[model samples]
Target: MTPGLRLRTAREGRGLTLERVARATRVNTRVLEAIEQDDVRAIPPRPYGRGIVRAYAAEVGLDSDAAVAEFFAQFAPVPEPVRPAPPAAPRPVRFRPAIDRRWATVMIVVIIAVAAATVVIAVGRRVLERRSEPPAVATTGVSAPTPAATVGTAAPSATPAPPPSSGVIVVLEATRPAWVAASVDGRRALYRTLKAGEREQLKGTDAVRVRVGDAGAVRWQVNGRPPQAMGRSGEVRTAIVTPSTAGSTN
Candidate 1:
């Protein structure tokens, strides 16, 4: 059976009303009704519609994963046949000349000699000009000394330092009817219900504590570490927590 049909049957079997299922799932009553009747038009787009259906099924004590899988099975499109591979690409061909390689070597040596001569001539002209010209005399009584050569004494250039790394932004929302509280670096964050597509940002340098119902508590470190347990609640809850570094920004 389809996921919507299965969900509806399970809900009815439990003697639960659409309104009761909606309240438990935190989804709209109309959406619950639409899923029960298999009215795809009433729900939002794909993934979102499937998520709502899953949430609703879970709330009504139905097999959520099975319902979701069935939902996709009923709605997902079939794959088309794979096309044949194209023909192999043509190989590149290289060509070599019959001329003597020594001639090419001689030409390269001549070019280098000409370039060195040009540089030597330029330096000689600058040196001769300085030697031929007389030094200027100062108008003041004191003679002005020639400045010392600046070779190998270049001034150090200033470079700007790089900015500190920014912390990650984690948005967490509940998928079921449950209260959620988050703590980052020992700071209490606001807790709220998980809407169908709600998001919240949590920032921290150390580990972050996320408490769901009395049965669910998961701690996440921002540095890609495994989740640790702080405590737990008795409902479906999710938390987005990021670890912070010493140089991380607030």
Candidate 2:
């Protein structure tokens, strides 16, 4: 049965009033009524909505986890049709003239001759200058020890910091327009439609819950692994990714 119907039936069977449930759960009466009616727009956005539903289910003596799972499952977005890509256009050709072989050879020979002459002149000047210098007379004396060069002293090394709690990272890219919602460590991180070629990154230590309207339209990488296909075109997919299941396709 739908979560709303189940909740309503349970409430009626137990002879509980909306006001009574609201007072106990600390939720508004109108919000409680909206939950029983399964009105998505009237309900608050997640993770608030998820928490509210879970609390209500628990108050009604139902399995909170199952109720929350089934409640969100009924609201998965419908997939859109995929379109074919357009054809590519052709390119134009261009022409160029060739150089004269004889002219090219003469230019190369001139450059080589000039370079060789310059090198020879430089070496001859250096040799002449060295030969022209006067020789130094030999003399020796005891010299005092030189003081050690003084630079800044070293400081003690600090302890290395601990790693972040986030053990995994997820990158989502849209190849085509699609709707996506994600939660990191039970907190809502993303909730909006993505344009083609757009990308987002999410990190979580415990879990990253994701729901995609068009599974085939989005490419994803977990913990910097290679991008993997999610599902067939127009398929809806929902999954909770943890450190162990970060890179696995399943």
Candidate 3:
């Protein structure tokens, strides 16, 4: 039997409907139906189609690895044998719009500005001390020095230090393939498709916001607290999520 038939038979043996399986897996109902009917050609490109099959198999308590392997055996493209062609340099892999890259750049500029200001303050203090002293204060005689204006630095304080940092932390887990756009502290952070089982963590001193292609497919956690739902199934929605916003937006 084909891999599709095996999946169909297994699902039927447990007397479950395609809709029930789709709901549990967060996969589309039509995709689940097509898989069971052995009409997965309707799923378009083979790679994403295979991902759907793998996720579905796992959700149904099937041997996911074995099912995926069998699906690959039936559909995987055969690689072309190497020939005497010109050598090509390896391409760099890129994750587009990576949030941390921009975040690091902003932090570097702030640090440089702080260092420059500190240097200017230190140099000015030294110049002022040289100009203020009297020329007669450097007398060679052994007589007890007249009290030329004296300067004293204050002693360091013995106060307790405060905590290092504090901020809102946002976590998002994608149960299915969905388009996601996120911003942390009003700056664009992530804008791309989140594949199944993907997770993102964001920290912001102000706030975090997100929009999802399918709101129900994502689960969220804020500020190290308990997990909460995002929105209704298959709903395209945008929400202003922060430490305070916990419930789904339906």
Instruction: List the global CA lDDT of all models.
Output: 0.56, 0.74, 0.68
Judge candidate 2 against the unseen true structure and give its global Cα lDDT, from 0 to 1: 0.74
Model 2 bad stretches (over 4 Å): 1-166
Which is better, 1 or 2, measured by lDDT? 2
User: Which regions of candidate 1 deviate over 4 angstroms?
Assistant: 78-90, 93-250
Q: Residue 204, candidate 3: how far off, in angstroms?
A: 29
Which rank order by lDDT, best down to worst? Answer: 2, 3, 1
Best first by TM-score, ranked: 2, 3, 1
Worst 10 residues of 2 by lDDT: 84-93
RMSD, one per candidate, in order:
22.1, 25.0, 22.8
Where does candidate 3 clash, by residue pair?
Answer: none
| lDDT per residue as tens, model 2, 1-250 | 7789899898888899988897787666766787888887656567767877998999889999999998888896557844323323323324332335555556677667767777787687767644443332334656656555557855445466685344778899998776689988768999976789999999888677788766787898888788876776656677777765564545
- The stretch of ten residues in a row with the least summed lDDT in candidate 1 is 241-250
lDDT against true structure, model 3: 0.68
Query: Model 2, 53: alpha-carbon shift in Å?
Result: 26
Where is model 3 more than 4 Å wrong at Cα?
A: 44-47, 76-84, 87-192, 195-250
Worst ten in a row by lDDT for model 3: 130-139
